[model samples]
Every structure is written in C-alpha cells, then in structure tokens.
Target: MSSLISIVLPVFAVIGLGWLAQRRGWLGDGGAGALNAFVFRIALPPLLFLAMARTPFEAFGQWRFLAAYLSGTAGVWVLVWWLAPRLGFNGFQARWLTCLGATFSNAIYLGIPLFETAFGALSAQPVILIALMMNLLLVGGSLIVLQAVSGEGTRAAIKETLSNPMLFAIGAGLLVSWFDIALGDGADRLLSLLAQAASPVALFALGVTLGVAGSGVRFGRPQWVLLVAKLFVHPALVALACWGFQADAINAQAAILIAAVPAGSLVHVVAARRGTLETESAALILLTTAVSVVTLTLLLEWLL
Candidate 1:
C-alpha cells in the first residue's frame, strides 16, 4: 500500500496541479497542446531511444517474461470487449475505448516516475520492457481497434499508424537498438535533454485535453465498468501472468504496478481522432485516474 501510494499519489498531484494551472489560465489554453506536442514529438522519442539504446541486449534473456506481460494485457482487452456491451457500452465504444483502456498504459509518464521512486535506476529495465510492448501495441494494435470500432477496415488504419510521427520515432529507435550503434557524447547529451521534458509536458497535455469543450467524460455505469477492469481486474491478471512466467520479484511488482495505471492519455487523442465514444473515453481516463491511487495502493500491498 505504501509503495503504490508513494508512487501514484505524487504523480497525480503533478497532474492535478497542471489541471489547476490550466483552469486558472496560468499557462494559457494552448499551453497543454504545445506541451503534448513537445513531449510526443521530441521528448518521448529521445526517452524511448535512450532507454532502448542503454539496455544491454544480453539482459533480454527472459523472452517469456515479456510474452506473458503482453499476452495478459491483450487477454484482458479481449475480455473487456466481450463484456463491454453487457456493461452498457455500445459495440464501437466498447471495442475501441476498452482497448484504449486495456492496452496502452501511462507507463512512460506515470511508470518512469513511480519506478524511479520505488526501485531507482534498476527499475528502468522492467519499465523499458513494458514500454517496448507498448510501442508494439500502439503502433499495431491501437490502429486495429480503431478500425474495428469504426467498421473502417484495415487500410485506413494502417495508413494512420504508419504515418504517426511518434510511431515513426519508435521504429527509428528500434533500428538504432537493432544495429547496436553507440550514440556519441554530444548526441547522448542531446537525447538526455529532450527526454527530461517528457513527463511534465505529457501530463499537462492530458490536463488540457480534459478541459476541452467537448472532452468532458461522464461517469456512469459503463465508465465504472471500464475503470474497474483497468484498476482491479487487469492488475490481478497481470500478477498471475507474471508469476506464471516465473518473473523475478521486481519484474512481477512492476507488471502489476504498470497494469494499475489508468488508461493512456493517447486514448483520448485517438478517440477524438476516430470520432468514436470521445466523451466515454474521456470519462474513463478521468475516473480511472482519480480512483487508481487507492486501488493501486491496495494492489501493491497485497501483491508486493
């Protein structure tokens, strides 16, 4: 409990502060978008690149560990999709939004900060492993969900994912990692500098999106169902999956903690772009985020 609270509360406090800042017009209305753009286009790329670049490929011995973590996430997504309509969500809304909630975690913004606080630099290994899976899902699976929800078929979705700048950066970073090229000192420093801006900007962007005119998420039965799935069911399954895969203690804890995060901020962005369940998607983000502090804390105490 202490571990989860220690991590989730402070991060959400930062987000709350950003929300207040936006509400008070301290940073101006456009500040959030600019922050998001900076983080997504510049900060996140360098962060992902540096993270991948620094990982000694030899440490990636436990392929099953990564497999279990990702497979568990996908499994939960499928469950959410099947149960969403019964839970009061429409088919399109349930499929995409449930996936948005299930798949991509706020692992970068929230996970890095929490992992750093709880376990220090050593935690970066598991976090990056999770991030790598996130890259794959965001690039591949997110598009699939959008297409399925919209009944738009595969071609348009593929085009959008391929053309996404953030996905392109992820692909480029993987290439650098695959080739095992060492970054020069100056280049390394530059990457470090850009990477440092990722969290604040990402959170602020979320705040701005939250404040958008049509972006308010309403908390009704359907939203609560998604929240429960994300905060409780997903974490429990992830823990079992991690244990089944024989993940080390730290890796297991990281899996559950990462799973405990609310829906990804990108979900709102995708929801808006796809024009499917935007309000419901926003509601899931806000509600899950608000409730996760307690739920995650409880999970940590029980699991840890």
Candidate 2:
C-alpha cells in the first residue's frame, strides 16, 4: 500500500500542479505549446534514445511480448472501428478517431513516467519496447486510416511519421545498440542531462493541455465507450495475451500497465489537423487521463 502511494501520489501531484497553474493563469498564452515543444523536441528523444541505446540487443528479440501486446491493441482498434458506425459515429473521421482513442496509449508522456516511478528506471526495458511498438503501429497506422477516411493524401501522414523525432531516435538507438557503438562519456552525459527533464515537464505539459483543450467540453455515451474501451478492455486483453503467451511476470505486468494508460493527445492533434471530431477527441483525452489516476493506482497495487 505504501509502495503504491509513494509511487502514484507524487506523479499525480505534479500533474495537479500544472492543472492548477493553468487554471490560475500562472503560465501565459501558448505556455502549454512551449512546454510541449521542449518535451517532445528536446527531452523525450534523448530519454528514449538512451533507454534504447543502452538496452541489450537481445531485448529487441522479445517477439512473444510484442505479439501479445500488439494483438490486444489491434483487436481493440478493429472492434472500435466496426462498432463506431453502429454507434452513430458513421463518418469516416469519427470512426477513425474512435478507433484511435480506443487503442492509442499515452506511452511517452504518462507510461514512461509512471513505469519509471513504479518499477525503477533500470526496469524500463519492457515499457520502452511497448512504447516503440505503439509508436510504429498505432501512430503510423492512424495516419493511414485518416488518409483513407478523409481523402487526405498519404503524403502528409507519411511525412509526419517519418519526421517524428522520437521514431528517429528509437531507430538510431537501436542501430547503435545493434552495432555495438560506444558514445563516449561526453555524449552520454549530455544525453543523461536532457533525459532527466522528460518526466516532470511532460506531466506539467499534459495538465496544461488538458486545461486548454477540455474547455467547455461535455461527455456522452460515445465518450463513455471510448473511456471504457481504453482504460479497461484494452488492458484486459493485453493481460490475457500475456498469459496465453506465457510471458515473464515482470514483462506481463509492464505490458498490462502500458495498455492501461490514457489515450494519447496525438489522437486529438490528428483529429484537429484533419478537422474532424476535434472537440470530442480533446474531451476524451481529458476524461481518460483524469480517470486513469485511480485505475492506474489500483492496477499498480494489484500488479506489484
């Protein structure tokens, strides 16, 4: 109990601080964007890079874990995609957004920080692997879905995915690890310094984003569907997959926790960019994040 509180409380407190700051106007106009830019462009890339670069090459060969996790995610996506039309989200954009909200986990902003707190940084290999897979599969796949639904050319989606610094960092890190290249002490220290800033900054930025984007939003039955699918169904499927695959206990728990994270803000970003379901997508992000605090804490207690 104490272990769970110790891990969960401080993370939520920082997020709460950011929410309060935004509510109080402590950060002026565009503050959230600036913070997000810093985290995405500067802090998170190095963190992911270092995590991947330092990981053993064999860690990349965990095919069973990957299969289990991706299977759960893909299942939820397909289920949401098919159900959206029946649920009155008949438009392609609406259907795509619903599918995205169901499967996309906030792996970078929330998962990494929470996992680092609960399991220790040295134990983040599973989280990193899952994050990488989510980025490639969920994020990349969203672009293709959007293009198909909205008649938007695949060029923009392809460009966005290819230009993602986090994806590039992951690839570079894996390459370095695969080739056994050493980035001497000087480079290591620089990366370590940048990596140290990812968690707190990301949490704060998330709070600010919630405040800004969730303004005047109202939830309905569809929103409830999205929340339940993301927070419960997805994780349950991942846990079942882990058991079926006979994964190690730690990796199994890690996969379930990652799957339980809230829907990513990227869903909202994509919806807004495509001019479809932007407000609802933002509301879903806020609701899922606010609710995930309790869900995640409970899951951590059970898993630990």
Clashes of each: 2, 0
- Mind giving the per-residue lDDT tens digits that candidate 2 earns over 1-304? 7778889888878888888888888999989999999999999999989888998888877777778898898889888999898777887778877898889899888899999998888777788788877876777877877786667678877887778898888889999899989999999999999999999999889888877788888988888888999999999999999989988888888899999999998888878877888888888898898898889989998998
- Please give the lDDT score at residue 181 for candidate 1: 86
TM-scores vs. true structure, each candidate: 0.85, 0.95
- The model with the greatest TM-score is 2
**Against the hidden true structure, what lDDT does model 1 obtain?**
0.71
Structure candidate 2, residue pairs in collision: none
Candidate 1 clash figure, as a count: 2
lDDT, candidate 1, 80-119, per-residue tens: 8788778766667546566666666778667766666667
